[model samples]
Target: MTLASSLLSAISGLRHAFFTREGGVSQGIYESLNAGIGSQDDPVHVAENRRRMAEAMGVAPADFLSLYQIHSPDAVIADRPWDTATRPRADAIVTRTPGLAIGVTAADCGPVLFADPRARVIGAAHAGWKGALTGVLEKTLDAMETLGSKRPDIAVAIGPLIRQRSYEVGAEFVTRFTETNPSYAGFFVPSERDGHAMFDLGGFIRMRLEHAGVETIDDTGIDTYSDERFFSYRRSVHRKEPDFGRHVHALVLEAD
Candidate 1:
């Protein structure tokens, strides 16, 4: 089965797609299409599954660049081959190499893609609440800028992630963030569940991008938890599932 995705023309004129869970060869909780190599799913299956994703993106599977996300503020500058298996412990990756695809695997976390068409620089990052708060998005922008991509000229997209309506968090989640800076209060809404707060992830990301001078932002508002079309770690955990599959969102530059 072929998965569904959303695409946009980024600054670098690269082909960028946000893949969903409509296609592939997995089953049960993994069900039909699980692209997460980090999951318990068969690694061969994951490779073949990624091969399909790369094909859809119009590139070889090896051209797809991604990282084992650690939800940290770190963003790696990937200029060439890096071990995909060891998977650098980073949240974002930036590069100027064409035909190299940048991808992010996310269920509820944000998959962000950036491009500077003039400079031929592109980036992909995984931005969950921790990453966003810790500056992964800004770090990606900075990395791209260092490689000759301008922030103002970059086009960015925030892919399928957990939406505010479907996302609820405990007081500690709120307290720590609030304590870090009450200004982050806008990102969270007061929920009825005790000291819990609902987070507006897309909104928060947009704010960050716009602040960094990226006004052209595409937001895929689909919630992973609320929508069956995508996977959600939080949802899986709530159901007492031992593990959950991850969805991949990729952006790649096609050879001109």
Candidate 2:
């Protein structure tokens, strides 16, 4: 029900998981393990699903924190747990506080977990195209730095999301990126449809991380759009489904 990163799993006092939609009470499009508090799934089921995730991470259910996720470049520091009604509105969260499982929810957007084992600091970011373009990853790194994590010492794991082969975009979508920097054009290639291209979001994310001096990055390379194991917003849209489930990718600094 969960996927672990080899690099993150090797760490002594850190726990992380890329949860799948396999276990839960929600049915229909949100069938099981939909951790999104914002989703249309029944509140009771969502709570129970998240409770299971928190238990797996060895944290109290209330300690499993997630942001409101506005798809912005904002990152916040989580010094303590906050209830869903009072969760902060941001794209990323970083913390040195042990036992607090900071996480981010996503269906097609990138869910990146970061950690600096030596400093006992960890972070989670929701990087959709907008957040990624606006520098959410860099902002997350900066937040982690404030919590005593150095960029060079941090290892990042890119979890499940829609991949390039399943992602096609229009001319304006390509232009929005290339217009930012001409070199950004290489991240895309011609698609079968006219005035469209297949964009490599994972590659783009890696480039941003590398440019920011994060040398170690492990990508799960799982495409949500094609993978039946996870939910996909794009796939749901394609099928005209009302909504989709969201996977919660989290990281925790365990208490000694």
Candidate 3:
């Protein structure tokens, strides 16, 4: 079987993918391509999987970048070549150099890719709920801008997150958003479970991007928690599984 991923027509200087699990060599619960190196999967397997990903992106494994994502608003700017594992702590990374990829491993959270073609800058972010509410996306955009990126010139995309139909959260979640803007409650759909509601995560991201002045945006309509092609922390917990996998969503610039 073939691996799953999406192609972006708008990302001109880069080759990007919201990669899925079908094309790796891992097995059992981790099962074929668990790209989350820090996951419970064997280190060698994760290494091989990431190498395959580099080949797919037309870059060496050293060109790939990821973060020690903690769902915070922090951003890291990479000014030079660095190994993927050694990249610093932050949910987002931006670089003005080409051949450098920005990536984030995710299950249900959003893996967001950004590129500013004119400025030769690229960025990637992992914006889970906490990161989103805390302005992770904005931080990434700001870092990219500092490296000479423009909000209007940046093409933004989000991949393989839990969709609203699959995301049910507690009422406190709604209260938190609504406390910021009374109308923010529109993103929630009341759930069958008491005091819980289905939240529109992708919608919230889009809403914020629009607010942040991003004119071009695309969303990869994959739900990690609901689909077996991807991984989901919540789904694993609900299924009582020992562990889950994280798919890598990456964006890499092609050096001129």
C-alpha TM-score for every candidate: 0.93, 0.99, 0.94
lDDT of each: 0.82, 0.93, 0.83
Q: Is candidate 2 or candidate 3 better by lDDT?
A: 2
Across 102-136, the per-residue lDDT of candidate 1 in tens digits comes to 78889899988887777888888899989998899
lDDT of 2 by residue, 93-208 (tens): 99999999999999999999999988889999999988999999999999999988999999999999889999999999999999999999999999999999998999999999
Against the true structure, whose lDDT is highest?
2
Lowest lDDT sum, 10 consecutive residues, model 3, at 1-10
Name the lDDT of candidate 3: 0.83
State each model's C-alpha RMSD to the native.
2.0, 0.7, 1.9
Off by over 4 Å in 1: 1-7, 10-12
The per-residue C-alpha lDDT of model 2 at residue 48 equals 96
Best by TM-score: 2
Backbone clashes in model 1, listed as residue pairs: 3-23, 11-117, 12-117, 26-32, 27-31
Which portions of model 3 miss their true places by more than 4 Å?
1-7
How does candidate 1 score on lDDT?
Answer: 0.82
